[model samples]
Target: MWIFGWKGPSGFSASSTAEEVTQGIDGSALTAIVTGASSGIGVETTRVLALRGVHVVMAVRNADAGQNVKESILKEIPSAKIDVMDLDLSSMASVRKFASQYQSSNLPLNLLINNAGVMASPFMLSQDKIELQFATNHLGHFLLTDLLLETMKRTARESDIEGRIVNVSSEGHRIAYSEGIRFDKINDESGYYTWYAYGQSKLANILHAKELARRLKEEGVEITANSLHPGAIISTNLMRHHGLINTVGQMLGKYFLKNIPQGAATTCYVALNPQVKGVSGEYFLDSNIGNPSAKAKDADLAKKLWDFSCTLTNPK
Candidate 1:
């Protein structure tokens, strides 16, 4: 059994709500983009950020679903500032378009929560003919972050607000293929297992965050990048693609899983907490910095994955 220790200095625990971690914090001047903001932890994250008076852009693939979420937030927090924007992470074209539109809007980006992802799904190719899980979960956010990075840096410089980038990774990152990432054969199906593919994508999320943090520091940028596990959240659409055995496990494991609020707490903590002001490239869990799997902490591998991702996203 996995044991979660004390809540540490944050005074928050695995059961803490996002609102609890962010209590009394004012976010009126900040603007954030939360991908997959339609439902589950994404929606909860968006709602809590909005509650704290942040101007949140709900980046979702489904416009209608995004609108509904927007309406729901506004109904509760009558003064909340929120916008619905269409984003399909599976398509590079869509990612480019979304980034272009947001850049042209002249909005300052203070936070980017790359919260969208796919789980264990049958093997499928994206529009770019790349594996679906890696494409959506890693490459899509990689490209989106790359395109908007300058905007974030400029915003931080002008507003003197610390820019934050949070990648919602999973603990399952440890379960990837023996090689970690299959650079030469991303599309190979001979040994493909749905969970392994999912794990590879998640591991990429961590590596992407770590490398991003290093590069930003090298360039003397104030933007901080970190990744996290939201804990095993129950009843989220993220599990829609789970296999039968996994589905059964989820059902049986429901009692130990986090509800939506608790699941979103760590994200809120990492994104808004003053305690983590200068912290970067760390993996967080249960509202505190925690060590990830040994593989997740391999710096050389992180850099390698960064190079591979850049090549994929920025083909010559």
Candidate 2:
């Protein structure tokens, strides 16, 4: 279970909590944009950063929920600098609007956490008619990153630090077929299974990190992108759209999986740890780099997915 360039704790299990992982990290001068920051793992991750003095932009689909999350954080840490921004990742149009506004503000974005995602939900179409999971979780983030690359570059240069984009993938990526991203059937119309489709979208997150890292390096930008699996946790509405079987599976997960804080551990670890400052395009868990499936490391597939995503989300 070894892979090249993996440099996290060895044999680390998935029970670490976000508060535990970020015990001593100082985040005073950092500004971050974290999607799905309104609840669950996202909310916990935001809290961890805010407690450390980092200004965070909670990018959520619903402005009301985003504001509520901000108030909750303010209540916990009265001096916490938190802002809410509207971003519906399922729509390319919304992603563009959000990125445009953020860039216009000229905030030095040290971290971008693509933490929002949906799972095992009934099949639904995005504004562009793509599958819901893939559209919101993968493609939206892809476009948003490209849109914000300039801001990230500026932040990296000004701070002399490696900028970061953390894609919150899942271990379920193991279910992706050997062929990798199935561009032809990306919409999954003919043979759609909720879990399988969710798996494919999660796999896209990993590949997006890998490919984006390579491209940013080639362009001489000091930015790092990586993916992680937040350990299974209850309390998130990610399963809100799930069917009975999926709901049952989520209940079973509570028995064996980490709690919400525990689930957010790897995400917080990757976002702020100096130990992993230069670690890009790697899969992580439990504050440690984990080995991805062989297919997950296929550069060709990653490139293909990137090109396909650009086309889907950035039509000329």
Candidate 3:
């Protein structure tokens, strides 16, 4: 049944739902933070995690939308523990503030899903003057993870529960520019191609996860970091930037694209599945481990990207 690199175990497929993959898993003792949980795959990921009895925090840019999603989930699962926290991943100040607020709460961090991202859009800069897609999709999550590392490590050591970090990368990572990350020209619009820029950001997502997993292992921290391609999902607002092309493409590809819940399956699988415990520094697809591009597997490139990210996120 495996075709085009989209195959999983017998029980799971491209159409498998998040709930199906997470069945029999009791997450009552765990706490998780899911970024961009207001809609699309984020909402479904939050719902399934909360349904499994995990305390889920919906981190979103729009507070009102996040509250609405939280309320909707509460209506379905009366006992579901959910909280809506403001987090705008495009701004460095916002990332810092959100991390600070969460740290002040003294909550034990169990899962941090770097699921928020932007897709192909006209060239622009984030508030920090970095390219928008690179900043929001990679740098913000990079900084957030750095800020929360100690908390996750502490929680894992004290609770004796392995912590997990899932970065929602995309298969589009392969379509990045020839240079991969274009580190020297991130904000240069003259050389920018929207889709390639988005690809670079997604590529960075995988690289970030790879490097973090390596560091955690080197430090003997009982935490795991992994990344995955969530599939081409049509229902998500990620296509809002495409305008007319988005509508046309969705119309043509709706039947082939994964639904929101199905799109979120791989993420939930990597996040809560016992089968993948201790498995880190890998790329996943369709609820199973899969290979990424050769460039993506380059450890030297990952380390280089990590160092660049640190400088961008925490400059002296």
Residues 7-31, model 2: lDDT tens digits:
3454234665677777788898899
| Model 3 lDDT per residue over 248-283, tens place | 767765666677788899999999989889999999
Supply the TM-score for candidate 1: 0.96
> Judged by TM-score relative to the true structure, which candidate is superior, 1 or 3?
3
What's each prediction's TM-score? 0.96, 0.93, 0.96
Off by over 4 Å in 1: 1-5, 243-254
Off by over 4 Å in 2: 1-13, 243-255
Least lDDT summed over 10 consecutive residues: which range in candidate 3? 1-10
lDDT score of model 2?
0.85
State residue 248's C-alpha deviation in candidate 1, in Å.
4.8
Cα miss at 296, model 3 (Å)?
0.6
As for lDDT, the candidate ahead, 2 or 3, is: 3
Model 1 deviation from native, Cα RMSD in Å:
1.8
TM-score of 3: 0.96
Error of 3 at 186 (Å): 1.2
